[model samples]
Target: MTQEQWTAVDRYFTDLLVPPDPALDAALQTSAAAGLPPHNVSPNQGKLLLLLAQIQRARTILEIGTLGGYSTIWLARALPSDGRLITLEADPKHAEVARANIAGLSDIVDLRLGQALSTLPQIAAEGNSPFDLIFIDADKPNNPHYLAWALKLSRRGSLIIADNVVRNGAVIDQSSSDPSVLGVRRFNELLASEPRVSATAIQTVGSKGYDGFAIAIVTTDQ
Candidate 1:
């Protein structure tokens, strides 16, 4: 699709799917000021997160990346009054911006600044309380590692949403040797064949690009 067409579609989907929220608007402003890469989840994707959280009546949600809290705010907003969300970010500066954006919502959200690879293990060691919903949007090259970690922390009915799986469709081109694309391709293959979960890859166009993502739901049998 042309860029304009893509933008139109995104706007249509988001408008029909989710209404504007003050917190999300503020978070977007913070993200812009931080000069961080536009890593925040898309509005339509955020709506999807909200829907998934509600579907599972998720009490504990985990997100591996917090980009100025734009996406974190979306996910946290969906939680029940008593529900909690733990988000990890490696950049202290980014975390600071995210914290500021997410101010006044500490009762339901915890923003941890550190390498997710390290923090995830620590969190797992502390308890066996599995997450009902896990969103992975960290470094693309670590997609495989993150998936492995996410599965361990996932409950039988949990959902694991991995963003940027398509890498702008570069994943299908074997000649494309970008580490991020290669990593995503491998991760997709692994998940597609794994017996533990069922997944579907959906193409989407938005600020990210003509890219797509994978949403995997862990089966009860596994």
Candidate 2:
């Protein structure tokens, strides 16, 4: 009925479905104590990410943003003991907070501190194996560029997800000067034209308000 109602329903269903997650709660508390923005994914969304990784049986995951490593932990926990998740964060302070939050996950979590545009090239140059799943949630202005890199670094059958695509219904305004909206428009066009992946955007509303995420699966024919 309303955003408040939607958010309340999200919390209601989350409590009825997901078991208690003290570690995740602690991570949020620590992040807040460190003065990080309260921009982490809600519990239900985090659980969705965890389940997505599990369903894909992903061994290697690449995340374009590591805001306090909240989502990073959810993805990491979905991996096998030897599975790895590499997250990129441009903010040194956020990266540091993420490192502290993921202290025991050193074996499976790799936090890279630098601009994704720069670090992604290094990863590609290293000739590292392609990530099985990639999550893009960084600066909205660079989403098109990020999608380009995501495609470049992904292998066939890889899953690519980009968050915050629909910012409060602003994505439909083509004439809008908002850089994020313009960037998402360009990114959506690119996704539509690219034959390398099959994708769709799923709109969502809840604690985060109106927004959507784009999910693409790399095709074998690409």
- Name the top lDDT candidate: 2
Please report the candidate that would top TM-score against the real structure: 2
Which 10 successive residues of model 1 have the least lDDT summed? 204-213
lDDT of 1 at 67: 80
Residue 42 Cα positional deviation in candidate 1, in Å, after optimal superposition: 1.8
Per-model TM-score on C-alpha atoms:
0.94, 0.97
TM-score of 2: 0.97
For model 1, residues 1-222, the per-residue Cα lDDT tens digits are 688887888888778877788888888887897798887888888887888788888889999999898878878878889889999999998999999988978999988889999999998998844999999988888899899988989879899998888877788998887999988988898898888999998887885677887999999633
lDDT of 1 at 55: 85
lDDT per prediction? Answer: 0.86, 0.91
lDDT (10s digit) by residue, model 2, range 1-222: 799999999889788987778778888999999999887888888899999999999999999999998899999999999898889999999999999999989999989999999999998898755889999999999999999998888899999999998989999997899998999999999999998999999998888888988999999633
Q: In candidate 2, residue 94 scores what lDDT?
A: 97
